[model samples]
Target: MDSLQPILNSIQKFQQQHSQILREASRVAMISNYIPDEAFRMAKATENLTRQLKIINSDSIQKAFDTISSIKLDLHLPSFPKFDYLEFDEQRLERITRHNVSVGWTLTGDMPINLYLRDEYLDMEHDEIDKIFIAFYEEDEYVQLKTLIKNVKNGLSEKWSEILDQSLDLYLEGRYKITIPALISVIEGELSSIIGSSKYGKRLVDEFHNKLDDKMKFLTIAAYSAYFFFDEHLFKSHDFTHARLPLLNRNWILHGRDDPSAWKKEDALRLLNTLSTLQFIKEIEIAEN
Candidate 1:
């Protein structure tokens, strides 16, 4: 993926360079119309004039950008497939759920209560969640996976924050080359631990199927990730509420834009937050809790 950074940077540079060319050509076109026949024929001036505009109008530039940006880059954690949640027994899940429930209760209380139950639960559940947040590789395989996850999550989240915030500028201006892939890389890199988890891979893939699109495949991939981790079910709620859902009706209903690739970054992040939070709650809620 390091190779991709340079290519992306080049795309940005090319866009800026060509934009200047386009502006100059437009000015030349205006001047040529009024200038006498002499300047128009001076330096193969007809050819030069047409050539500049042709370069500016070439569809290949935009198509090239679209192709590179659309190329899917799966940012899976290296050891994800080995960590299987289903391997744990029902009793283990119950234990983890009890821990999560106790923590939820304790977090809500004002004064200190007998949090021994809560602490016990949180400690055990924390181990599992930590494994999901960080990589669950052999201890020797990753001496500082915990620290790595923390740093990466912060950096990656901030990176995607910028992309989502500027989605409109990139798309509307035909600058997909500079924006789409960047958003994908940031989101995938940030959420790799949970996104790549074997426990949730099927779910992630399922969501991707629903959101996939060609024009904005990079954004679509990112959006699916948002929904994968942060959808509505993760939070505590009596039932599904319209306001509770991430990006609820924003595309197909709100804007009538069914194209998933066109979704803004914040919308994608909101979806991810909703899905992930709901998933966390559902995974913790046992038959008893």
Candidate 2:
């Protein structure tokens, strides 16, 4: 169910170009040239070109079928024009060309073989094919989300795996009510693990805050002043308030006071991203140590 649009587009472009060439060749074969050998040469070239074109057309059709089949979607493709008539016509041309090329070239009885080309078959099926690609694009997003969750889970301790798995499973199953809380639990679990670690604990937080302050001070005076104002009114105040408020501090979700209906998919995703960030930071710390 991966994207088939690229392949489909390529096939369409090839068909358009091929059809144009076939039309020109057919026109040339029909022209009554004064030079008899020249007419035979054009006929011979057109016959060989048509044969090659038919093979290319057939192969492209087979490719489209193969791609559709691989996705496991039950889509019916429209019937393509029969190549049997074209093959028979090509064989007749082959005989004509062989006779003309070997002996004296005969331009008297030569006729233009009308090559069958249908562009409408693809046009009719284009919408259905596009729908399949749309579905595949959604499926691909879900797959990528799952992969990110899996990577974050792997970076965590074994105890947090259940929380991560349960949250994702519920999310996928459309149980958003339960999925939000489960995701919240995963975030809390990862945060607790990091803060409760004997080697890193609250001391790491203190060091991180100090480093952040030092970095902020090194900015230009105007930038530092703006950040200082933000720090006092927004960042530090929010941190202090968040630390004091039980519900805002994750107490309600942890203690089962938050409404499930109020939670959203974006909230869950943001929490998951935070957990992923924490996991990345932990890995960096481990590497440094």
Candidate 3:
């Protein structure tokens, strides 16, 4: 209805440079220890291109709003918080213990793979109920684990959509900064409720949320991961992490200035890509389980 054509056209313009975008995306996918080095450099270059374009078309602000509104997102958003962050069920902890698996990792860790593995192990234990760890742990069992994760993820996806819708509304209404925390609280509550609803879902979701809360403790930071994409237009360089480069680039490019670093697009995107890829790896590991 908003003539998605303009937004689509802009994305198409960028898509024309698909080769570069894909390269950046690839680098982003494996920006972690798993990927090579040459691609990292290329990602930086592409990121610069995005930054320059953003600067040239300061009007990109409008285009961004228009494009975002035009897209037919499949995500299901959650509702606004009934109360404040103080109202969330912070007392509750994940049902899964860290000792259940051999990885010496908890279900709650920054790397989603860790949670994915933990979830897989939990599902295995759940199905067998009495089998010793040695007998149940195997490469093939990953399929069942993934199925369980998918169930929880599907439920959470509905929540993600809600979070996005609320955040977008606040953003469009010019209340983003002021109201974002409330939206984040809603997101946390939704995830908490979903996790607590099912044994398997609770195990996986709690593990993930606990880890996130430990590190950042803010729902807004974690929620941003669900929808944020890479924006290569900011910064000249940054360090590395295990994330998707495009998404990282977009995050830093869009918000890096809010950080004191004035972060380099090249470095930030590389690191962000690594982190994103790691997230994907975690998803894959969970899916496989």
Candidate 4:
């Protein structure tokens, strides 16, 4: 399993904070002599804050569980044991008062009433929870890749926005095959908008080549190299002449030439990154012109 230390450490920190807050609340209730209503209000406020932390902890656990479960189901592996969030019991404070009395030649003490509140608490197997998170992170490379796509999408123009969003949504929903083609559409649309209609493939490359001097020629070639390399690598099938090309085999996805059952998360991620890079170059070119 990949290191989930960051998330696990965060959970531990929250747990420690929760414990400290509960202890503070208990101490406040014990030492304070505020009116009954005021004390109750203060206690309730502490309880509310404690409840919010509990919710955050539970949400983190649930996200880890769901990510692991999805991977297990997809790979036909045995599922991890299901676990539930720990629920804390409600808290209440009781007020008490003490008095002393003297009789004849002797002094006596009455029962000293005690004021206290139950500490907020919940318990779980920290090791087991950590294991779940570890498993999720081990197989969760797609999430990191999706974040890359999202960052790139943030800079995209309004024309490509909807398709970029749709592609991301499809990827997250496990529709891996569909997302590849959808992302390819984003690349196609953006390039067409930049280069104008009736010009793509070799023609677009030539246009850049024609417009550059010797010094700028390498930049133009480098830009075209990225454009053609990604397109052919991710979106095209190998021809006899192009057998050495890196093949993501997205042509199968786009043309329905074969079943998309072989599509993997990495394939979609690579395509998104490739398309994002191409769009970024195109944006620069548009600005320069």
Candidate 5:
């Protein structure tokens, strides 16, 4: 056994060497696995960085976008579409119209208020609505009316065009009695055309308004007194036609009971504004259908 000690020591040394070789191999295998994973992670990070750089590589492009965002672009937009030209919502428009009621001018939603006036118009008082609304026609020397007639009637001598011409001529000559009734006939005819009914009186307004959405109905509310706020202002009974400034009654005007003095250029302007509003209704009807 003493003689075999050297041999045993040699065997033990060989075992230790083999174990060290196995440990080295295991470590190399682990390092090989770690190197691939670390390289893949680095490749992914580089790809993401490249993508980010591509998106914002041009400082000038980014700066141009920033500059455009800072600017306002509203020029040449005066005759913009109805929705675009209308700066206020239905509620704001109603509030604006109601502002005129203080001056004995019962402004309904039918009247096309100058929306571009914005704060200047809304902040006004003391017959300002009339000065801005009705006077524009007089100031423009009925050129506005001529344009409006063209708009409401696509072609001459069609759908109240002849009568409209007659009314305008009578109005020009100060024959308001002739003009007002003729204009009233056109208005009633326009309303009848919209409602697809023979007549538009009393409950017919409600029926006419039924075809409109809340926003579109704002136009009706803006029209005569009979729409949203039915009252004696615009549609006073024929028997009670004794009148004032805003009391331009449809029944009174139509039945020959209204004051002849009530029909003036201003009244003609208002009815024309109403015709424009009805044109809006016609547009809405076409769009919805």
Candidate 6:
């Protein structure tokens, strides 16, 4: 028995560390946005924007952004898909995306988190697309996230305003444990509201099936990720274990089984952005109906 003392102590310590979780059998988990050279990623994202800093007045990119931003769904339902349309200059998109992919980054579209708002620029003529791209990708505490918050602040549903504002503050303060759980919860809540269904977890992914177009850039991006949250064995589908590595597993987080150590800024930020995209879809739905 004495020989097993050290092993027992290790197990005890682990359980003690997560006592709060055991108590709850419960609880929850975003990014305000990554780490391990988060600074480098921010700098690189900004620098990479320079690599393709070419925008033409009335280019398709600009047109799509303008249309999506202001299109009134009721009046423009037939034309909605037209305005929503965007094409990528394959080479340019590849350049922009490849680097981001290398860093484990992806635009949160369908889930529409990508800068390719049909998803940039250098010294040529800058326009709204450039601004949005930066807003979507920049990891800087100093970026347009504040502007995003401010612009939408007055417009958010009261329930959302509370959760989002508090989560954002926690994320910015590097309190991933608090922010991550709340974002995960609110994200699920918002999705339930969006789909007008009570479906939860992987069930939510099924709700999106009929709603997606696959051809529309933003819709596809946003919805693809919503599915991702519960699909592809990220969570729920897998059996739970304390030894499992954390990688944005919704089940583990919600069950209070995930280690906060693995919940990085990326998790919080991505979910926040996902919530933002979901809000956009919900607003569009309200307008159309």
Which candidate gets the maximum TM-score versus the true structure? 5
Put down candidate 6 lDDT per residue, 24-90, tens digits, no spaces.
2111101112222332232233222221122211243445334333423222122222321234444
The candidates, ranked best first by TM-score, are 5, 6, 4, 2, 3, 1
* Residues 80-140, model 5: lDDT tens digits: 1111213334455456455554333433222223332144556776556667666545556
Candidate 3 vs. truth: CA RMSD? 23.9
Off by over 4 Å in 3: 1-155, 190-282
- Misplaced by over 4 Å in model 1 are 1-88, 94-185, 188-241, 245-289
Q: Candidate 4 clashing pairs?
A: none
Candidate 1 has its poorest 10 consecutive residues by lDDT at 105-114
Q: What TM-score, computed on C-alpha atoms, does each candidate reach? A: 0.19, 0.37, 0.22, 0.40, 0.55, 0.52
Please report how far candidate 4 places residue 193 from its true position, in Å.
Answer: 2.3
TM-score of 2: 0.37
RMSD to truth, every model: 23.1, 27.1, 23.9, 27.0, 30.8, 21.1
Question: Residue 65 of candidate 6: its Cα lDDT?
Answer: 38
Structural RMSD, model 5: 30.8
* Tens-digit per-residue lDDT, 57-91, candidate 1: 23423343344344343532122122122432335
Using lDDT as the measure, the top candidate is 5
Enumerate residue pairs that collide in model 5: 108-222, 109-221, 109-222, 109-223, 110-222, 110-223
Candidate 3, residue 286: the lDDT equals: 46
Whole-model Cα lDDT per candidate? 0.32, 0.41, 0.32, 0.42, 0.47, 0.46
Off by over 4 Å in 2: 1-141, 195-249
